[model samples]
Each structure stands twice: as C-alpha cells, then as structure tokens.
Target: MKFDLDDQQRDFASSIDAALGAADLPAAVRAWADGDTGPGRKVWSTLADLGVTALNVAEEHDGIGASPVDLVVALERLGYWCVPGPVTESVAVSPILLSSDERSAALAAGELVATVSASAQPRAVNADFAGLILVSDGQEVREGSAGEAHDSVDPSRKLFDVTATGDGWAADVALASEFGALAVAAQLVGAGQALLDASVEYAKQRTQFGRVIGSYQAIKHKLADVHIALELARPLVYGAALSLADRTPDTARDVSAAKVAAADAGLLAARSALQTHGAIGFTQEHDLGLLLLRVQALRSAWGTPTAHRRRLLEAL
Candidate 1:
C-alpha cells in the first residue's frame, strides 16, 4: 500500500513548521537552559493555541480526538525545533493515561502542564515545570512529585527523580509506554532531519580549499546518506502510528521497529552532522550543538536503541 502522507497532513505539518519558525526556538531553548522558562512557556502557549495540546484527548473531554498518526505528525515538527519540556507526555501519552481524571481538561486547554514517569521512563522530564507528574506501570497510575534534578545531555530537558504521592488509579501502562516510544521515535526523525538540514546549510556556506565544501564528494556522500536514512525512517514511524491508531496485532512490533530505525537514523545523522561541520559543530555557540545534543538525548529517550532492537527481535 502507498505510504505517502496526504496533502492535508503535509499542510498540517507545515503549519506547525511555520508556527515554530516564528517562535525563535533557539533563543527559547537557551532561555530554558538558563532557568528562564518564560519564553518557553510562551511557545508552549502558542502550541496550545494551535490545538497541539488537544490532539490526543478524547472528543468527550473537548479534545480534537486525533489519532496517533496525527499525533506523530505534530510531534515530528516539535522535534525538528527541539521544543523543550515533556511534549510527548503532554501531547500524546497524558491524554490516554489520564483520560478519566479531571486534570485532563486543564491539560487539554494548556492551562496546566503535566508529565509522566514510569518504570520505563525512570525520570520525569521537565518535572520542575510540570504541575502534575503521573507515575504508572500498566496496572495503576498515581500523581508524583519531583525530588531532585538530574542533568540531561540536552540542557533543555530537565529530568528529575520522581516518587508517587496521593492515591492510585487504573491505567493501561503497556499502551502508554508503546505510545511514548512512538512519540520519541517521531521526535528522533525530526531531530535527525534538523541535523541533516544544518549540515547541508553549513556545507553550502563554509568554503574550503577555494571552493564550497558541499561540492566535495565526501561532504555530498555524507549528506546523501543521512538524507536516505531519514527518508527510510519516516515511513516506519508513520506506519507504527497507523498501527496504533488501528489497534492492530502488530502494533508492538511496529512501534519497536520504528523506535530502532529512528534512533539509528538520528544517531547516524548526528555523527554525519558533526563531521560535516567539523570543530564548529561541537562548540556551544553554534546552533548545530543544540540539535546534536538533542539527538543524543532522544536516541536513548522513551527507550534505548538496544532495548527497542531487542523488543523488535522478541516480536519477531
């Protein structure tokens, strides 16, 4: 069957791109890293206004009632900009995990920011900013609190140790974890694309040996390889989204496979990007460093490459 994204989906994704393009996200990211969440929160509000916060919430709860496919489409764009905080948790997993809870309404409206942490997640990302942290493990979910901050490779991600508090309620932890993994996979694809885009732009501008480096065979080859990998990974991510949306028997396998492919593609793009940009890519001042660090963090988020590969093998 054809796997191309329809015109409407492409247009929707472009709208997110346009919105974030105007958000000055790199500046927002720097502000977030320095403990100034004002700019970041403003961007979050912009996303909320775009109905991103309501993508996965059920219609009964005044949500857009979107499918995982639509969720991933928006998620990929969020990743491209390297938007901070628990985007996957807030936009994708939380709605499904906290559907019955009253807080879900506030979350859908962007009036509150919530996050999730489980045995799989281990640490709550952006916990310092989250108004609610839900801890779960497939059978039950409970509100939790942040105890201590843990530094992440990506400075924008503020991970924290979490402990459950208050009463517990039932939830489908398995599905939430699967959806979380799928969201991260989509993010990886976006991060990988960011790396590729940055590298290509730098190559076109940075001259070496009296000519643009992008004209060199080696540079061209590296960029071409990353492009190919990202192109291949995109379908798997979207396919898994479709599988989850349809509640198919192979949903687990599809999600796991997508995670593995995305992580690998993202990491490959990272390495290639660093090579293309040379020493400059490693420096903090360069914007490429932001996407590079994000790729490293996302490679291991939700699930590691090895873990997903193992999960895919088990399914096989």
Candidate 2:
C-alpha cells in the first residue's frame, strides 16, 4: 500500500524544518551537554511556538489533537536537529499515556517537561531536566524519581535510572510502548537523513589525491547505500504511524519492524558519514559526533535491536 504523506503533511514538515533550521540547534545541543539548559530551552520555545509541543494533545484538553502522523513529522525534524530533551516521551508517549491527566494541558503548552520509561524498558531520557518521571509495567503507571544520572553515549542525552515511588494510574502500557518505539524510529530516520546530508556535503568539499572525495567510487557508493537504506526505513516508520492511528492489530509488530529498520539505517549512516569525514569526524569539535552518538543511543532506546528482531519474528 502507498503511504505517501499528503500535501498538507509535507507542508507542515517543511515548516518545522524551516523553524529548526533557524534555531541554531548545534549550539543548543552543546549547551545541553554542558548542563546549561538555557539555549536548549530557547530552542524548545521555538518548537512550542510552532505548536509542536501540543501535537498529540486532544482538543478538549487545549491541544491541537494532532494525529500520530503529525507527531512523527514533528519528531523527525527534532531528530534531524538533534534537539536535546525528553522529546520521545513528551511529544509522542505522554499524551497517549496521560490523556485524562491534568498535566496533559501543561505538557501540551510546554510548561511541564516529563519523562517516561516502561518497567520492561527502564531507561529515562533527560530525566534530570524533566518535571515528572513515570514508569509503567504494562498495566499500571507510577510516579517515579530519577535515581542517578547515567551518561548516555549521546552526550546530549541525560539518561537516568528511575524507580517507582508509588502508583500513579492505570493506562494501556502496550499501546504506549508501541507508540514510543514508533516515535523513536521516526527520529532515527531523521538523524539518518542528517548524516547522509552532511556526508554528501562533506564529500563535495574534501579532496583526496587532488580530486573531490565525492568523485571517488568508494565514497559515492557508501553515501548512496546509506541514502537508499534510510529511504526504505522511512516508509516503515510512516506505516507504523498509520497503524497506530488506525489501532491495527499489527501495531506492535509494525512498530518493532520500523524501529529495527530505522535504527539499523541510522547506524549505517553514522558509520558511513564518519568514514567519509575520516579524522575530522572523530573529533569533538565537529558536529558529526553529535548525530553519531545520538544514533548510537537511540538504537536501543525503546527496545534493543535484538528485542525488536525477536518481536518481528514472533509476529511472522
């Protein structure tokens, strides 16, 4: 089945892209890594003004009541920019998990930052900065506290070990897990795209043997392969989003497949981009490190590659 984004969706994505492009995200990511959230908050404010913070919220709850597709679109842009925050939790997972909770409105307005992790998958992203941390065990939700900061492979990500303090509510943890996986998959696709774009741009400028590296068959083939892989993975992500929107019986399987494909593709892009950039890519001074580390951390964010592969096989 064709799952192309409609014109409106494309336009909305373009708008987000434009806004993010102007936000100086690389500097913000640097500041986030240094424990200074001021610049990052400014960027978040930019997204909030764009209605991104409210995408998944219901209209009755003072949200735009956006679809899963819209949420994915916003997240893809977030990933492309490597925006540092609890985006997957706040933008994708929270509204679904806390639909009736009073905090939804504050979340939708970007006033409240929250983080969520499942008991089955217990790692909270940006927990130190989030106003709330929640853990679900497939049946019940619980308020949680960040125990200790765990440094993520991605310098921009501030992960935490969380433990439930008490019960919070009853919610569909299964659906939340699927949605979280799908959203991370979308982010992976966007990060992969960024890596590809950066590699292509670098190839045109870097010279080897007095010729543009992009002219070499090796660089050409590597970038082309990564581009193709990411292109293929993107559809899986969009398809999973549609499955969630329709409440399909295959949502879990599709979301797992999407996550696996997108993670693999994002990793491939990171490796290819690094190889193409050579010594420069390995340095902390270069922005390529940010995307590479992010792709590494996200590869196992919602669920590990092994877990997703196993789930896909079982579904088959």
Candidate 3:
C-alpha cells in the first residue's frame, strides 16, 4: 500500500491552501477574538463553497462522503490558516453523533455549525456561534444548549458549558473521540509547519551582528530540528487517518500515538518560533502571536499529550 497522499489529495490540499492564503486570516482571527464573527464567518463561507464542510457527512445527507484522509487534508489547511470556530466539531465529530438527516444536511450545506461536549471533555467550543449543540455521555448523545462562555488562551477559541436537555440516542462516544483526536493531530501538524515556515522567513531577513540570522549555525540547527519534528509527525497523522478510514483493529492506538507526536512537534515549533522572533513574538500585534497561542491551545484540546502517551502505552 502507498504510504503517501495521491495526486488528487495533494491537489485538494493545494486548493484549500490557495483559498485560505487569499483571505485576511490574521484580521479574521482578530475579529473572531473580539466577538465579531462577521469576518471569520465570511472565511467559513469561502471554505464551505470549496466543499470543505461536506467532506465528512454521508452521501444520504447530501454530502460527498469523502474519506477520513480527505477530511484531514482539509483540516490541516484550516489549521495552517488559523481559521476560527468549531472546526473539528463541525467537520469530524458531528457527522457521527448527529442522527437527524436534516441537521446533517444543513451541516453539509454549511447552513449550520455545530459544537459538542462529552463526559471526558465537558466544554463545547465556540458554542455561541454554533447552530447545533450536543452533549454526550459515552453511550448516549443529546441535544444541548450553550451556557456560560469561558476565555481560552487563544481568544479565537471560546469554550462554553453545555446543558443536555432533550432525549438522547445511542452513539459511540469512543469512536467520536478518536476522530476528534485524529483531526486535532492533523491541525497540529499543519500549525507546526506554519510556525517553521515563519521562523525560517524571519531568520532569512533579520540581521544580527551585521549578518542575517539564518546564516548562523545556531539558528540553522534550531529551525532544522523544528523541520524534522514536523516531518516525523506528519506521516503519523496521515497514517492514523488512513487507519481510521479503513477501520483497522489498532485504530485507537494509532490515533493516540499520532496525537502525542503532533502535540510534541507543535509545542516545539511554537517555542522555537517565539525564541527566534524574540520579544516581538509575544506581542498581540505580531501575527506570529496568533499561531503561538493557537498551538498552545490545541496541544490540549482533544486530549493532553501526557494523556495520549499513557493511552498509547496502555494500548500496547
């Protein structure tokens, strides 16, 4: 079996990259943080028009029924651009939890955004912006409403308490958690790559001691290490995606391993990027701050690295 993405998948990734590259992503992220969803929603609309929202839903729900690998491809680009909202929920988890065809169809059509909370992860992300809210307790899922909003390190990510009210239906919360972890792993890989790229570009132009910092051995080694970590983590992310798509026996184990690798790589990249840019990287006005904060937030979003590492060890 091939261990790489085919030409078609590469083309799809490129299309998403180009589309998001054109949008004012930094501005959109800022707007979302300030409780102004108009700009971010416009960016979401652009992604919907590209068929991103339909990638994971079933064909019966007017979706493309694309593979999990395809969903990862789209999400990676979203993370690279730092797109705001409940991305993993709307694209990865909701399709599995939602029993109503009408709700699924609305999701496929991008007419609805959804957020979910589970027994393990009780807070729903961006609940105020979601059209649908779900609360799950391992075996059952129920419709829910958003409660109080809580601030996140990444302002673009708003967590909310949710209260389950309606009758519930049977669903596999374990499978949904696996999918969520897989999606977050893919995004972490993308965000790491973005960080590496920014650091390299800054090193090339910023001069120190009358010489470009990129020429220094120390900077070179640091950036090289970041590159190596991201490269190592990326394949694991895709491999886990493939395992999930094929329903392999070791799917959960693979997903946990991938999550650990991605989280480590993403954190390393964030630290290196901040160090490379010095004090400017910490300022809110700097664009790098957006990616830095996002990487920190996502590192623990689905499950913490320590938790995933323990899960991997147990699965072994």
Whichever of 1 and 2 has more lDDT, that candidate is 1
Instruction: Name model 2 segments beyond 4 Å from true.
Output: none
Q: Total clashes, candidate 3?
A: 0
lDDT of 3 by residue, 1-316 (tens): 6587889989999999898999989999999999999998998898889999989888999998999889899888888989999999888999888855468998988999999998646899999999999898878999999889999999999999999997998877788888899989889898999999999999999999999999999999999999999989988998998899899999989999999999999999999999999999988789999999999989998888988899899989
Model 2: ten consecutive residues of lowest lDDT: 112-121
- Per-residue lDDT of 159-217 in model 2, one digit per residue for the tens? 78988887578887888888889889999999999999999999999987999999999
Question: TM-scores, in order shown?
Answer: 0.98, 0.97, 0.98
Q: Candidate 1 residues 1-80, lDDT tens each?
A: 89777798899899999999999999999899999999999999999998899888888887889888889999999999
Model 3, poorest ten-residue lDDT window?
Answer: 94-103
